[model samples]
Target: MNRFALCYFLLCVSSAATAQDKEVQAIRTRYQETAKKVQLLEQDPQNAALYVHRISLNDKGTPWPAVGNYKKTIKFYFELGDEQVHTLVRIDITSESAAHQYATEYLFDAKGQLVFCYDRMPDGQSPENNIEVRYYFSGDKPIRRTEGKTISDKPSPEQQPQAKRLQSDAAELQSLFKAIDK
Candidate 1:
């Protein structure tokens, strides 16, 4: 084929791929929104299980951290089984004072129940006062967090913090999917 003809063929292929990516992305966005909306309807108090949204909540909030630092973040992990329950939850402090201590992790259930978690201050000045967590067995189910019943043997209320930084640049991530669709 002539040089111009070969170039045209390649262009067509690229265009097709881009179109496909857009369609798939559209579906993914819809599904994500559906899940979040469903959770909101089911829970309603803004305290139920957390779900991921198509757009990053951080996007609308303050700018990400500076050089040599991970960006601020608020994260939620959904369950993997039948209805995909929410297992873990966390919120980052997002302030410079906290620095390395941006996220103080906390564990929770789909019903917004608290569980054992780990947290340490950035200055390392905290004593045994550091975040303490305990686990207890309550009848058939595990009661991780206790309000004031140590005899009941419930775990303390704390959670593990999530990674503050994005795995990759957002623009690049979007472009990658776009390329795939083509």
Candidate 2:
């Protein structure tokens, strides 16, 4: 390749990388802002328009007692407003036993899109060691994920399926909210 052509190609690639970096930064900023809003709402729950529902689940992820077992409990949090059923914002799932404890928090945007998920569970190597993972999404697409102190801008193969499941669970919970509102 000629020297001029090589230089032009490098410049183009550099510009593209810079633009992508800006986009990722924008996404991160937006996620942080939304997270702050969620925090404020949580702090003053009594003053916010909030709806909460709790359900018990067995080891198989089904409703408790149906399988004659009790495992975890999931709490759904919805922001009540004109949109009503379309305002699902957060979900907290917790499980505790003699052997281990696990918890996960799913956060959604105003449009009922899963935007962030925080999971805490035993690392499996030891009962005292727990791992925490934070997954961030732009709409239905995972953009960034973090495990403990390590962060990755690229989403992993499993994150896609996990994102879909979280979204599906949010939708199901929203449907339940709609039914209850009726």
Number of the top-ranking candidate, with TM-score as the measure: 2
Q: Model 2: per-residue lDDT, tens digit, 20-103? A: 567557656755665565576668866655666777755464444433333888777766676554466677888865456888
Q: TM-score of the candidate numbered 1?
A: 0.28
Whole-model alpha-carbon lDDT for candidate 1: 0.38
Find the number of clashing residue pairs for candidate 2. 0
Best lDDT goes to which candidate?
Answer: 2
User: What pairs collide in candidate 2?
Assistant: none
lDDT of each: 0.38, 0.70
Poorest lDDT segment (10 consecutive residues) of candidate 1: 159-168
Error of 2 at 71 (Å): 3.9
